[model samples]
Target: MALELIKGNTAVAEAAMRAGLVSYFGYPITPQTELLEHLSARMPELGRAFVQAESELGAINMVYGAACTGLRTMTSSSSPGVSLMQEGISYISGTELPAVIVDVVRGGPGLGNIAPSQADYTQIVHGGGHGEYHLIVLAPASVQEAVDLTGMAFDLAEKYRMVVCLLLDGFLGQMMEPVVMPDFQPVRTTPPEWAVGSPDSKERVVLTSINIDPPNQEQFNVKMMTRWEEVEKNEVRYKGYYLDDAEYVVIGYGTAGRIALTAVRAAREQGHKIGLLRPISLSPFPTRAVDELADRVKGFLVVEMSNGQMLDDVVSIAARRVPVDFYGRMGGMVPYPDEIANAIIEMIQGEHDVNADGRAKWLAKMRELVGTGE
Candidate 1:
């Protein structure tokens, strides 16, 4: 197929359409409004359902409703908007409904800004909503990756009967790149037996998060945890770059991962044995891979657009086997390749402490570089 230059948001919308998305409900939010706009025109043209919801809450519930009927349903939002949908997301997860949610993350704490940021890492990966539930979070680093992962999100959501999240930075969502779109896959015409509208179903299908009996709720929670374990074992995905002779590894995801790659290459050219580990799935975070690399690498440098949210995960997996350091640019700011390369060099050469002191030092340096006062 010929590649077309498309914005990340448009690519995801197009990919979902081709992947047989039957229903879409979303509210317009910066860095991801294009996705909703694209689907509004495309879905109805294809005779599928599309709704510009009253709000994020309305949108997520609409997704929940569509998904209950065993339809391919999705919603997109930025950080603040996603916050509004958390309750609905939790309900969907508790009910074991399959759905896709795209979070084109921007700067955040509260309506932080519409610019690019990776601040939503903890919210999306760690439960954004209340419950003992896990979301299958796929972090795509590029426009093409966004397209591919969006399709994969739908398939995985159905296969596991869980919510799948496509987490991307706002930069990726707004930027344009060449993407080879996937071929159209046939939509599921026959609903599953558990679906609300299954044909000739004598029993009424009830989907709800409520479990009045304590024992039954405990049992349901156990089942959810068991399924999460399965996902962790089978679904962890990551890409290793120049890891063979690497003495130092840089870990990141989404747009930050892509930038880290450039830094890795630059450091390699400067005769440093630097490598990169990019986590594709944030939920089932490639902990095993990091553990394996910990034995070989001297230390780790975690790069992120947020204030080291994912760095916490890296530190847990590395387990102080090798020192884990961090450099971050929060509030929608992006770090440059040279900045990352320099950090890699510093991590390798400096005999830094692998504790809170080390993190403080690194953060101080980052603040200095970004001209933020202590």
Candidate 2:
């Protein structure tokens, strides 16, 4: 295939199609509607299934149904829309179905702006739905990354018989980048042994999330835990830059991470020995790598488009070994590279106190930036 300039959502849609996606069920939501629009025309042309459901709730249930046949299936939505699909997401998890979800996150406590925000980090990565189930979540920082991860999302979902999500903020979804997409994969003609409606199995196959018997539910829960352990062992992924010898580290994911790259590079050029750790797999987070960095680095700075959500996660990993500071822009606001650059300079120069209140300190900086000098 040739490299083509593609928008993030279109690239993801096309990548999923070529990855042998058997069905795609989703609703139209900003930053991700392009994905559905592209699949609507492409899926049917390839003789695959494509349904734009009435709502996010309706779409997720449709994905659940398609996945029951052991088919490669998926759905995409923005932040608020994904929230609406929570119930269906939990049901799919309880059923242990392999289905893909694409979340092009927008800003929100409620119907926030159409602009990009990484606030969904905790939502998708931490399993917002009501359940003990775990999702295989991938965060992408570019259109190309989104394309690659979308393909992987399906395989990861099927590989573990668990839900997988491509979690990119609205910025990545709308951005355009050049990418050489992969060729089409072989289609699945037969259902898995556990799936319903398999002709090869003469015996009846019943696929259901309903475990009316408490013991049965408990058994399945234990099985999920074992499978999640496998995921943690095998699926952790991240990208590091300039970390071979660094006094401080900056951590972010998706758009925030992409922007942080600029800040980190600019800081390095100005003689600051800093690096970045961008986690590709948000869930099953790169904990070991983080633990190692905390042991070596003088301090750490966590940046995000949300109000220090992932900061808490990194703080937990650091365990007070070194100071971990936070800088963020929330409610669809994105931080400038210079602002993050300035934050990095501050962290490296300030008292590297182990118990410093980074969020409170960052909040003060934000207040000054937004506050009028009256």
Candidate 3:
């Protein structure tokens, strides 16, 4: 198949259209602005609905309405813009609305900058809104990855009857690379039997999470937990590099993982045994994969562009079975491969203290949460 060089944001928009999204509602934000612009110019020719919503909140609600009518819908934004959509995302999760959200992340505590950052990992995977629900978050490390994952996200969203988030960073969104888009298709949707407002309302039903009864809320939590377990069982996804006989592993996701690969290569050349564990699905988290590596590796160094949010999972998974250390560069800063290589070398050489006890306590807590308490 022939490939065309395209920017990540443009590739994502093209892939979304090729995947047959008929309704798009979004507010433009840096890094992802090109995607919306592309869609705005092209979707009309395909007879689709594309709205530059008044606000992120309005955009998400528009998606909710379109999704309720059984259309494949999408929205794109950066970190601060995404924050505004949280309430709508939460509501959609409670109602099990099938939609795809693209977050080309920029730095943030609040509108920090328009540079790439993985600071939103905690928010995306651990529920950014006021609920006990999880979005299936996919981290794309490159332009092609961004495109491919966008298509996969829409499919998974419909199949699971859930919200799916494509978590990319500004670097990936702006970088240009060759990609082969899938053949275009007309939009087709089969509303879940449980979807609300169908003509056969007496036979089917509408359900929301706004439970007034205490038992009902408890039941909702239990039900959502069950769904999450099912997701972990079937959907935890990751990629490993240079892991054979390594004494230490470097863990990362999204664009950070792409940069970490360079460190892995350099470390290997220096005769330092280091591996990379890159999780594609942040929500399901690829926990078991990390656990398997934990039994083999002596230690792990988690590197990210945030204040160690994902490092928590690495610590919990490795437990006392191995040492775990964290390193990060926040506020849109990205660590160079040399820096990461040095960190891995330090971890393996025992130059820095690794938290075995903290890892042990975290493991116990995770075990309790997952009902596998040891």
Local accuracy by lDDT, each model = 0.91, 0.91, 0.84
Over 1-374, each residue of candidate 2 has an lDDT whose tens digit, in order, gives 68899999999999999899999999999978999999999999989999889999999999989989998999999999999998999999998899999999999889888999989888888889997888988999888888888888888998999999899888888989999898899989578878888887779987778888999889989999999999999999999999998889999998899999999999999988999999999998999999999999999999999999899899999999999999999999988999899889889889999999899998898788886356
Kindly state the number of residue pairs that clash in model 3. 0
Model 1 C-alpha lDDT versus the unseen true structure: 0.91
- Please identify model 1 stretches exceeding 4 Å from their true place: 200-202, 356-358, 371-374
lDDT, model 2, position 147 = 82
Estimate the TM-score of every prediction.
Answer: 0.97, 0.97, 0.91
Q: What is the TM-score (0 to 1) of candidate 3?
A: 0.91
Candidate 1 colliding pairs: none
Candidate 1 total steric clashes: 0
lDDT: worst 10-residue window of model 2? 365-374
- The candidates, ranked best first by lDDT, are 2, 1, 3
For candidate 2, the per-residue lDDT at 135 reads 90
- Candidate closer to the true structure by TM-score (higher is better), 2 or 3: 2
> Quick one: ranking by TM-score, best first?
1, 2, 3
